[model samples]
Target: MRHIILFFIWLGIGQISYAQEVRYETVENISYVDETASAYAKEQCKLDIHYPTSGENNPVVIWFHGGGLTGGKKEIPDFLKEKGLVVVGVGYRFSPNVKVEDIIHDAAKATSFVMKNARKYRGDVDNIFISGHSAGGYLALMITLNKTYLEAEGLDADELAGIIPFSAQTITHFTARKEQGIDEKQPTIDELAPLFWVRKDAPPIILFTGDRELELLGRYEENAYLKRMLSIVGHEKHKLVEFQGYDHGMVYPGLPILVKEINRLVKEKE
Candidate 1:
């Protein structure tokens, strides 16, 4: 009788272990750039996808890297792994070699590709979230608020599940202004600024920034104004969070918050 009880207990433990396992796979360098685009773009415009092998209709987070629009490589942080989600790290052409406008276009093309192929990876197009640090965050806001960029590639920006930009610029990116020899200290909100396209009807947005005193170049204040304007304009789903002890490099602490937001938003949708 005791042996029989032990056998059943072992079986239950094995079942539990199997149920908790999350099998995943990684696919690298899947090009989303057009054939007509320049060779440099084709070389740089690629994405790396890491997804769970199980679970249908899973959520996907598309991550952009921060390098002030002139540098930075696509990277999937380890903090986001093994969470029953798909994370895509995107690579795009850099500045000086390519203008910031071209980079935004590349990001749009990559997002369109992800939306169209989500199902192949067992992901939901409606549950796709866009996120990134610094310049990458700027890309997320630009492609989302402007809409025209995604529309050019036959995808609607409004279809995104959420936008979570970490320490991003709401004004015209300083890099863009630098092209015209404008100083970084002098801010501008022009056609390229995400502030230029704030609307009430857009998808849910979460702006994450570091402590105001520690963040670089007023990043936290910029995002605060963005949240305020979004609210003033009637956007109900927008949220802004400031990490107390973190600085411009807030992605580490922000990753867990992202997961929480993902689960919260995705569950509400379900």
Candidate 2:
């Protein structure tokens, strides 16, 4: 009887802690400009976050918007917000304002910031998941496959819990190659390409793309190539999912499945 009473007391305390957890939203203005004149202006490069309430020790997802790296906004995906997870939506200077490399670095900065400060918001730093759509997906792959960027922040790519890229580019993104006057028909695996960085021991990766026939601009093919490369490298925890009727926009059609996958992955590790 005494032990039962103690158990209830302990349960009650835990409940209070969970109930006391709070949600938060904030922005981080990160800069990348080198010139003094442009530096302060670069500070406008900001990231918005929508966090859970009280207990910040849950999973975190650093999400990016899709605009081919040339156009996009910093907004969290609708389906992701209500899934009982912390979502950090990042905004970086676009291609014309800054180079693609700079944007990639900004994504890293935002992700690293989320990871480092997750505990304060009841987020589990160890369980950080990086995901994005289209251009955002490209960023996710870059951060996961290339250790150089995240390494600079003292965070290893392997440190990420999971990576789910929604129809990212498998080859060098056309916009990036365009800067070099590289034609679309060029088959070179340039350094700017994500395909140039596949490894065997990357964190768990789940690639999702629309049906091959319905996807935009061969996006599905790019995802397929990425999956193949990951496989060729002996990636153990990588998976490829095809959204049957979904299109390029991952807003509603792909939301439920994506959330389901995250929940499944989280539950599996538990």
Candidate 3:
């Protein structure tokens, strides 16, 4: 069934009141790549983590920021704080400086690092989720759907607990198309598109998009198609949510939905 939700009402469903105070910590600029990697890789492929200081086995969320693949930095959203979860913000090499494949590999490497070291920060390795906004959302989908990237890191894409992308491009990212001398307005779906690699056995996916009329050109439609295709392939654990009255900058309202999905997935896993 198609699930179209109003952001305001859904936001209230996952609201949790903590009886005890929770403490959080932030560690910045930890390199995810090895020393033997290129200087640019060492500099660009770094991650920042915000985690609870006193909780054991807290769920982990790795966030990628939106900048259309050419810009933007890693950030731990303020909304995700003090929620008894570990949030990792990742930074990767931008295009023109590196190929989109390299950027995706960087994401995989960061995920591998978090999986290996989550225990050091009081996080559960098995309860890891990946998410991002816009271009960052695209990156999250790429690494999760295309197993080769994570496989190169000695990890499996299925290792993730869930995938939640906010207004991500389901087709070839416009930026990747631009690199190939294609117009941004022209939609293409090839290896770089998340739609190109749909399967029934990947992690549970929750796709969030802004209002259909207000989003970036065909953004909501692309995600809708992705949802349809996933169902056609017999994927049962997925949902597509469109926020009414919000545009492409819908990350704010979407954050609450993200938290709700994470909590729900964690509960289901238990």
Which candidate tops lDDT? 1
For each candidate, what TM-score against the reference? 0.95, 0.84, 0.92
> Candidate 1 has what TM-score?
0.95
All models: lDDT? Answer: 0.94, 0.78, 0.92
Model 3 over residues 33-68: C-alpha lDDT tens digits?
A: 887999888888899999887869999999999898
Candidate 2 achieves a global lDDT of 0.78
Candidate 3: give the clashing pairs. none
Q: Any runs in candidate 2 off by more than 4 Å, and if so which?
A: 1-44, 185-187
Best by TM-score: 1
Model 2 lDDT tens row, 152-212: 8888888888998888887887778777788756655666678899899998999888888
Model 2 Cα shift for residue 204 (angstroms): 0.6
lDDT of 1 by residue, 28-132 (tens): 999997789889988999999999888888899999999999998999989987788889999999989988999999999999999999999888888999999
